[model samples]
Target: MIALCTPSVWAQIKNSEHPITGYAPVNGLKMYYEIHGAGKPLILLHGSHATAATTFGGILPELKKHYKVIAVEMQGHGHTADINRPISCSAMAEDVSAFIKFLKLEKVDILGYSMGSGVALNLAVRHPDQVGKMVLLSPVYKATGIQPAYWPMLPQITPEVFKGSPVKLAYDSVAPNPKNWPVLVDKLKTLYSQNFDWDQKKIGAIKSPVMVIVGDADMVKPEHAVELFRLFGGGQFGDLQGLPNSELAVLPSTGHVGLLFRTDWLLAMIQPFLNKQTN
Candidate 1:
């Protein structure tokens, strides 16, 4: 059955507005990304589990109409998908920074979803000069501490871990496991997820406009998202945009998956915000 995506979403992909492309980040990591329109450059970062295709699939077309959109597939996921992936989220953030430099692009727009948001936040926090505008979709901020549930993903050298194809199996399970929250949490812990601290102070250090968003029914604790918003220094536009210009959009009855996939709802929440950026 064909999915019912918002007309704008479908139009972006259909009208050949956004063209899928790839980039070889450091270590020959062939990262996948897509580009659309020709205005201010915008980079799209997808969340965990699936590839960029899954997260940015709907917003591509619509966004293409406004700014230059670039969707990237982080290592071990999507086009960069591979097992025994050499790095964690922090490393992935570094890879993104390298990609931007290799492209010879000084500054651009960024929209991050779920895990992608974390990666984007890391870049903004660490490499401020690389990004102009930032959007944190269901952002994950470890300001207080790591979630107990993510303990499994913490680094652990298990003899049996590298056995067969641990990486592929890990990616394969992202979908089915998402059905049950607890089970998913357990799986993440087992994956040896790293607990990297996100310094809220660094967020304030970011010299760019920022937007934070989350669905009221989002599964990932909303507080985490709020922490990210507040980290931006929330003054107004141009000042980090932690909480002020960093408007939080929460759709009632929308779960994490719904927020990421709901074309109309996502457009309603993000379109205006994005429009205001670099417009």
Candidate 2:
């Protein structure tokens, strides 16, 4: 079961005391983003139904100390407000790309969790030039990448299921039109239920270095994560050829929602990878 981290809880624990928050008009939607710290850019994408604060609140202080963290709220999620378009990963990626252009940032690192991981993947694939390095946490590269049991549960995630839940509460608290709760839920259901997968060849063609992080008990299967790692030139015998540009980490005793909350563990893995010089 995914643990809910409400905004109220985040405010208390978030390390970064303050952030420069704003909305960027991109792809017909006012995409909300928060900038923290200074230095190299690091774009953060939150999972489905999660706000930026809820996803990365715990790690903001540490992350910001090393890079300029840009946390974005995708369409229909968090402060971005719902839009008329479909909530597919590709569409969200395009919005992120536009947001990057709007900010005039050249080559930035990106880290995404769950649904956001898919968006980060699409962004790196479609606009390779903009992405420097990537960190995908519990990403779903293909429909089958998700565990079999999770597939059946997707259709059952209707608007009614979210009533009184943290996700709904979070949405109601910040959404411009709180009454449009049903609309956002229904759109997310559509996004979750859709059968979508990126082409493996195209994914393999991506040049930017990547780090694939997954929890042992995550919704995404471990073997599938390994497959994704291999597609990016990882999983080879490192002792013989030296480590590949890509890397993978399967955190023990962790689940999807718990993955982001493990800030120290994530930073330990992520910082080293990001600090490495890219050839």
Candidate 3:
């Protein structure tokens, strides 16, 4: 299970709120998003069944300081309304790409956690020209990247399983139609239950640099994280040859959910990588 962090930072972010919020008409659904601060665009995608607030609340304050943070609420999540279409990473990536174009952003950095990470990866692979860099937190690129034990649990995540939980409560608070919670849950269940094994050739062909972050105890196995890093031209012994453009960080004592809560730790690692000048 993902660990929850202290509520102070979350409260602060919610109370202050994003200065700008709007819905971008993309691929039939009006995708909701919030804009904070201003600089190089950095699109943030939340995990399954989560709002941008739920996933990035703790770190948004710091992240916005350096980026024109665009925190997106994917279809059927948060303020975004439900649609008739099925939810999948590839489809969501397309929506995001269109949203970026709608905003006239030439190229932007992308960051995502869990399910959102899948979408971010797809975005980089499918629309390489639209992406500058990528950060994948607690992500699994392929079906086998996830632990075997976790596969069986996907089908078990029904609406009833999330009743009264923070995820449900968050949805109820911000969803355009609060009663559609069950429908959102059902769609997420279907999305998560299906197996996703992206083409390795496509992943290796991504031109943008990437940063892969995972908890040592995350749902995604550590070795899989290393393998993904390697795919991105990272994980090399850089004693003589300089480090690769791609990077990896396995936070100690962190879990899937807890990984997002470590704002200070994440900032320290993420800032330097983002600030570095690309050769």
Candidate 4:
């Protein structure tokens, strides 16, 4: 189930025709963003070392039909250049908060993949009023949520490791400084090295309803996803107590990157969940 994804397996942002594209000055960084469609705002956050277009391009068309999709490329990723500050979810979350304010948006729905999940979670916990709903795909609440086997590979990751890979190609295609791939990798390495554990109280205290999705064969432990669901008032006998505001999904036979390919399965769950009323 652990296999490398080819370039064809993922969609590129440049291939899609988006109506709005610009760079926003937020938190001392120029963040690249694209806005498509109309109606309620939906923010899309990509995984580590990924661009929003590469991460969500496959589903962007469908997402835009129903939402005012705002896909952003965070610092050191995509068209955004690297700054002297280190990369961390908390800091990125702050950048996003500033972005929302910059856009003059009141509340928006956020869908975050992999590393973006951490940023989404941080935003929900830190600025609950600004987030209406959240979708956390392949989330990690603590360092240990990552499988033990994958831990050994983190310290060894290099820009060269992604050579000739879709990840690298996507980065090379649109990054402001394509040669700075190594710099992005190094910053991400520092982010991964830092000890991170969101307090259980913070997870449980998040008021915004969330949808947690993961692949059964994901690098993140399935048990860890379950634990997060429990914190969201899940793991209950719904037949007796009614459904919780939050939701959980485990796509069968899916790997981490493979989870993005399951677009049909994702929309099937996401559309109804997002449309459902919280009140």
Best lDDT goes to which candidate?
Answer: 4
After superposition, candidate 1 runs with Cα above 4 Å error:
1-20, 81-86, 143-196, 235-243, 277-279
Model 2 alpha-carbon drift over 4 Å, by segment = 1-5, 12-17, 192-194
Q: Residue 271, candidate 4: how far off, in angstroms?
A: 0.9
Worst 10 residues of 4 by lDDT: 1-10
Compose the digit string of candidate 3's lDDT tens values, residues 69-148: 99899999888998999888999999999999999999999888999899998998889999998888987778778878
Clash totals for all candidate models: 9, 0, 0, 0
Error of 4 at 63 (Å): 0.6
CA error at residue 254 for candidate 3, angstroms: 1.5
Per-residue alpha-carbon lDDT of candidate 4 for residues 25-119, written as tens digits (9 for 90 to 100): 99899999888889999999998888876688667778888999999999999889988899999999999999999999999999999889999
Task: Compute each candidate's TM-score over C-alphas.
Answer: 0.72, 0.93, 0.94, 0.94
Candidate 2 per-residue lDDT, tens place, 208-277, comes to: 8999999999999999999999998898887997889999999999988778778889989999999998
TM-score of predicted model 1?
0.72
- Quality of model 2 by C-alpha lDDT: 0.84
